[model samples]
Target: MSEVPEVRPPTVTPVRVVIALCLIAPFVAMLWVGSYARTGPEFIGIPFFYWYQMAWVLISTALTMTAYQLWQRDQRARAARKDGASK
Candidate 1:
């Protein structure tokens, strides 16, 4: 009877850390509501709180894209390593 080897998850690299941060940014921003809960600073009459969330919408989009790119690179690297190991 042959035993099957367990497949471990890929190791985290510096690039992956950056991707994690990029994904976490929006959650951190919205969670810390006190920082932007104000009206004095307005963009075209939009309240700070409202504008802040809206701004995060765009920022989150960019960050998500960056994170996704990083993830793709990591996956490619892992796949290459797996292929090389199997040969």
Candidate 2:
């Protein structure tokens, strides 16, 4: 009887770490309310708290885009590796 080899998950890479950070940074910043709860700083009469959240809306979009791009790159690299290994 032949034994089947176990397939292990890929190890974490620096690219993956950066991708994770890109995805998680917005959540962390938004969830950590106390950090931006005050409204002392005003921009064009807008309170800091409101403006900060609004700013994050754009920031989150950019981060999400970056994460998506990184994820696609990682997937392509993994696929190439897998194909090479199988060849």
Task: Identify the runs in model 1 with alpha carbons over 4 angstroms from their true place.
Answer: 1-10
Q: What is the C-alpha lDDT of each candidate?
A: 0.89, 0.89
Spell out the clash pairs found in candidate 2.
none
Model 2 lDDT at residue 13 = 87
Scanning candidate 2 in windows of ten residues, the lowest lDDT window is 3-12
Which residue pairs in candidate 1 have backbone atoms (N, alpha carbon, C) closer than 3 angstroms, thus clashing?
A: none
With candidate 2 superimposed using the best TM-score fit, by how many Å does residue 10's alpha carbon deviate from the native?
2.9
Query: For candidate 2, what is the total of clashing residue pairs?
Result: 0
Cα deviation at 28, candidate 1, in Å, is 0.4
* lDDT value, residue 77 of candidate 2: 83
Count of backbone collisions in candidate 1: 0
Model 1 lDDT tens row, 48-74: 889999999999999999999989988
At residue 22, candidate 2 shows an lDDT of 94
